[model samples]
Target: MNTFSRRRFLQAAGAAGALALGAAACGGDSGSGSGTGGASALTWWDHQLQLQPAKKRIFEKFAKAPGGMPVDYTFNNPEKLGQALQLAKQSNQLPDVHSNAGLQVPAPQLINEGWMAPLELSSEAVANLKDVLLDGIHIFDGKVYSFPIFDYHVYTNVTWFNTKVAEQAGLDPSAPPTTYDTFRAAARAVQSKGGGAAPWTWNIGMTERTADQLNYLAQAAGFEGNTGMLFKNGEFAYHDDAYVDSLDFLLSLKKDKLMMAGSESWVDTDARGRWSAGAACYYFDGPWCPGVVLSAAPQFAESLGVAPILTPSGGAVRTYHGPQSGDYWLTPKSKHAEAANKLLSDYFTTPDYSVEVANTMSQPPRDLDAVEKSTAHAEYKKLIGWFRDTVFLAPTPVVKNVAITKVQVETKPVEPNLGTIIQGAFTGDVPDVKAALKKLSDDSSAERERAIKAAQAKGAEVSLDDYAFPDWKPGADYTLDQYK
Candidate 1:
């Protein structure tokens, strides 16, 4: 985003510089609680940083609202939260209300390890969220441990443009560039009419995010699932032409000198500042883009506009997600079970809470209907339409057979995974991108089979078929009727 930034910012970003991440987590005064020296106190921990202002506002109201308790609220970034929760698990210091967002462990393992306690919300409360709930995803072992307060039908590759940058560069922010060629043209146009900022920028320093955009772009290029699982043959297929083409397309942008100089080393947070300052013309990010802009750079928020993702072939981009599931979990150690349940279920589903969450515009509320009537930004409302059109619900292995979670737990990560491969290509480490992808695909397949066998030996009834969905078609919804 800047010489002071692009060079100096991200070296200490992400995992390498995360040693004191626990201290980074701000433990707010639990303004309201059971008042027994943290005993039976309803504590809540979240990983969302962008909406802290809104969260605080909600909690402040909640403390005074019906059924609200003194929530000792805390915040952690996802990476640190993963580490914090792991340690908490060992020490039995798990927060009564925490999220499984970055744990990487499957829900089954979390449940079996006593990571959760059932909310047992009233049927009325459960029915209020029926629109986004999935049988197996929101339900585990016939009990609801967690349920989403937001929707997950979002992708990371939406064509986000600074409206000011676009119009000045002779491009229509309303009609965003829809194809690779046009996207490049828009970048060149913006660069030619530069106001000191570059035409385009990305958080390429964030390997995982960069990798996600690649997979998502691959899906736009006609791949099936978000990851390399074809589901057609029930196997990993990361080396397909879709992946190569997508990676090639991204590399082409860098090669063409259309990116902000030194921007490759920046993370999304870095790019956000640039984008908010109107130093960037285009970004590929998700629903939270607008909210973050509004919060961090309000002056530039009005200039931010979103369009559907720019696909390789100008086709509908389908970002596949499984049924909405619980993000927040109640730890087994919670003594404020009744109060915690209200915070977890009753409050989350309440109309007032949903409206506040929807308006916050980080993750959309589970109630899409509330979004229409809420005070959310127009860009956010537009995002909802895109989600309905482009986000398809895919079948999950855990949904079909819960034991597959055990297999997932057994499966080890294949190194130089897609994100790293893409990052290597960007950094000129990987000479042949296609070959690297092929090796990754093969490695993933072998590892998956090995894990399946190991889990089977342990009496987990998972098989290759558990992952196969022959009925799945690219860009189409994997309906429940076809779950067999």
Candidate 2:
């Protein structure tokens, strides 16, 4: 199946019934109630509505809020949230409070289009937020428009290994490779075991996943750090030497048959299934793997080992980290903006609520301290520690120029989907690494130029200089301060 279609299918499966039933049956209105002396009808939509117990607890808590608003809570998967929102927009009945569905559309775009309302945190809420959330995650253009609820602590580029596979292959599962050359050696050892196991498996058929894998390899090579998209000195740097080297390294693995057979056709679930089944010794995924794998193959729990992606000798062990998940936001058309914000602030910033979110989601909460003191799960705490010690934030540059922002956010001057080009190289369809990279670079540069012109036509003040950050270095923190 096409990876895109497969993802769509999975998302649609969760939402089809609710969508068909329309807003009425999907908790459209929880009826009117006045316990705390406020208009008691506010709609809240979240992706986790399918979890009945959690849903009930959340509703119960909201019902007890100071204002005591009756929340018409609706559930839809993140993948379908955007679509649902669009439908709601058409009907002029958008939810007062909702998650960004993983920011499917960039926050800036949503704000600029007047779809999302800017947030106003009280002094107390601000202090609470500062004490818990990481700095610079929710702010945009000097205003907060979103709030962090749940975050994946472990960077997304982690490599998970089956200890049994490593032991069978005569490798030390205790000391997983931390360098590329050593990693290759380990791969060779795993392959030499000859029990139908492969060194690595990934959702190679998916453009986004394949691109992320390439980016991880690039991170190991010490070119770009964790920000998966290529942005160097304020411009797309996808066609650079480091990127080519990364592709060449991946190509080497493909040529050597280190990747599981038929992996190029595998979707995310297929790859995950193979990894859980021990068909592959190595898999790359986020922090959620332990819970997922343990649930699927409970007996194999003791055999699982997780580690950061190996860096090249002398390279920084950096990978993309931070809140790459859904976030809560207030809608522009919300009549209960103050009430919605109050509920959200209380839910996200309050320690008990934050801890509950962390425990239930098996992810870290916005409150890092809450995570430390959490009685949620031992495994989650360990994962949080690993994440804190190992990962660094890769900040996305905020260009002052609207044109530049349009290009970077809305228009997306460069497409990260190089899977076909990469697959061609693996299959000997495109053999020259330098030539392929040059073509990619040239195409991206041209698209960027086109975006600039388009932005200029719309009265944007943008230039190449707007995209330049010459002082920025690879493997170092890129923060909002850097933009200043």
Candidate 3:
């Protein structure tokens, strides 16, 4: 769910994930009595509302639990939590433990900037979380920071449909088409006959998703890895056939009038709300959509059916996910690092907590075995099946060369990036999709080269070669061993 999850948040989340908490307590002030409640109470910040019940049960019993301390827990949506954290960081106040949500920078940079502390965990704690650990992701420079709390095989393009609408369109809800042409045809059927609502809908108004949707759609077009940079070589491929054709497919939906009205202005939740109420036939989303739909459109629950994103000509699809990363992090400034580590290492990683994480379903646990005893909804559990069976774990430049962090740190953003290019394409600001994509690819590569030179100047041994992974395959996990 990265396009919808953590990694793909590289954009619009620029500031939105910081809502109430951004202005509320200024980050529990490291659990000081001034912000949280009382002295020595560990303040925790996260945006995972679905995990609230599990977290609450733990916090309520925490003081009595191992590594337990009085916890001052705060929850907000991603935007608000991020805002609060950024504000807190600026003010020199950060929570003892918080999820790595809003700050979209690479984890290594986060640590280098003093936004994180090396989690001084016991050897036993490290051993317990070892199976889920990855270098450059949870661990950096020989120190453990955090381990993955969620599964890695996830993406943004899970195709969800309203059963009622499928029947109305004379398509099988249980077995929707997986081919691009067939899927588009089916969408057209839905528009012409399925309740007179838009055939398909998404929050196109959210520019970031346009980029993300294109990311996964490129896979459906039979491309491998992320659309940002082709993993086969250390080069940007924005104008490559995969991305250009994928964008063309998206543009066709708009030109053919299959997109929902107001989609141009709808945010994700709004589009989901409308889709839930039978206003659209299909809503292309992520594994987490079922949970969101359950809350945002409860009545749509029984009528909902989820399937993997369709591929062009049903080409075997492989929606790749970036390396696993820890959600929770600690600010080095916190006075309660030990207590925070205890909470994270001693308690949070336990099978009991994992079962709770599985039960939440909005965010899947790193190990699907946790689902064996989870009480998650059938729809939620079904989505998990797709994630396990279809998604791929891809190699990362960070893993290939940890020094890549310096390049990330030095590389500044280029204007009219993928998101803006997609926006311009749809709004007719850019009439030549291929040309725009080529320019984007070239510009990004140039920026990266300059960044590499800049980082080398600073004595960080890195280069564009760090981005290439020649041994990577289409359908398998690109584990650490494959990096070199």
Candidate 4:
């Protein structure tokens, strides 16, 4: 049985529930007492991604404000926080400041319900957020809402190849493939050796893995729009031809037997193991794999190589140019907004604290001064340098009903069912591409209509267009004739 729907949907459900709890934990209203009257205690809630760094900043560095009261912190994962906060809301254990990845599972609901305090980064802080670092995380309605942890992503995908395998295949390891054709050619050459494992290994089970696979192919083929958000010209277009073609290309890869055997069964750990065992010539994944590599096969680090995904169109998709991983800290209608901001400013901007935080988590510092001051600079140089020079930080998509996005990401109905329609087409369980595409187009249309109606009820206007997938010449990104 396919685990795709189950895994993705379960995540969405958990996330939705988590956000609900986050909202409840920090009640919609500021309570009866002002934190300033006495020794104010601030509670900080954040995800575990940057735990050590956060702990170092708050516990060791900023616990006491000059002569003021210290912070009281509780750490939890975003998932646990959701559940815990809901209970806390009832018991009045809500935190003063919460840090979480902006635009993640809990943020949408929190934003919709007005459970979060609006963050106005002072001019000094805003000026520090220049193009040198990634921006656009703490934004809603074109105003800042939270302070982002870091400006560069640690999860950007890299194209990695095995030198020995490439050399044995009589291919230049340094001049690796730069297009789908070349990439496939390299994989085939490596596979022909008949001695090692599969030629290519990649993330197959994760949602982002699926999305990234589709993104690499679609962008290489020249699709110039967001796959997740089929919105354009103030409307959502799920029936776009490029969207269809993206699915088709992914299905073609599976059908061609070009991917690793049992790829669909492989998760990150399994895939990483395959790469570390010298089982594949190429591994397409994020840079965080270095840690896995170190643990799995330390020697693999020396042999490791990294490069951006090749585009058939010779244009970069700018994956490295976006916001880095980690959460943004938000104040939830705190009685201590001023105190909270001061702590946040010191926590995020101070060189000693910022460098300490960035170094601890291997995250690129958001403050240029902090980044420049660090002696452990080489650790995050690649992640920061590429993002600084090439990435374009854009605003997160305004998902009107995050529940729908969650549902869409997670589960699909069986056969004639609506949710699993896209997966069916890719898996060849659906016999006709045209019919499957048509049904998908129809389902998306219905979803858009429902979304528009819902938005209208909330006193907002929305229009949606169908997402389309178009045909294109092999190796061409996108062309006029590709669309009808």
Query: Taking the tens digit of each residue's C-alpha lDDT, what string does model 3 give over 3-70?
Result: 12222221212211101111111111111122444456888877665566677787778788766788
Q: What's the residue-level lDDT of 350 in candidate 1?
A: 72
Residue 276 in model 4: lDDT:
66
Residue lDDT tens for model 1, 272-338: 6676688888887767677667765667667878877778767556777665667677788787777
- Global CA lDDT computed for model 1: 0.69
Full ranking by lDDT: 3, 1, 2, 4
Residue-level error in angstroms, candidate 1, position 57: 3.5
> Higher lDDT: candidate 1 or 3?
3
Cα RMSD of all models vs. native, in order, equals 10.0, 10.2, 7.3, 11.4
> Candidate 1: lDDT of 263?
66
In order of TM-score, best first, we have 1, 3, 2, 4
lDDT (Cα) of model 4: 0.47
Encode model 4's per-residue lDDT on 263-330: one tens digit a residue: 66455556666776777777766544543354335576556655555555455544322233224445
Per-candidate TM equals 0.86, 0.72, 0.86, 0.61
Residue-pair clashes, model 3:
12
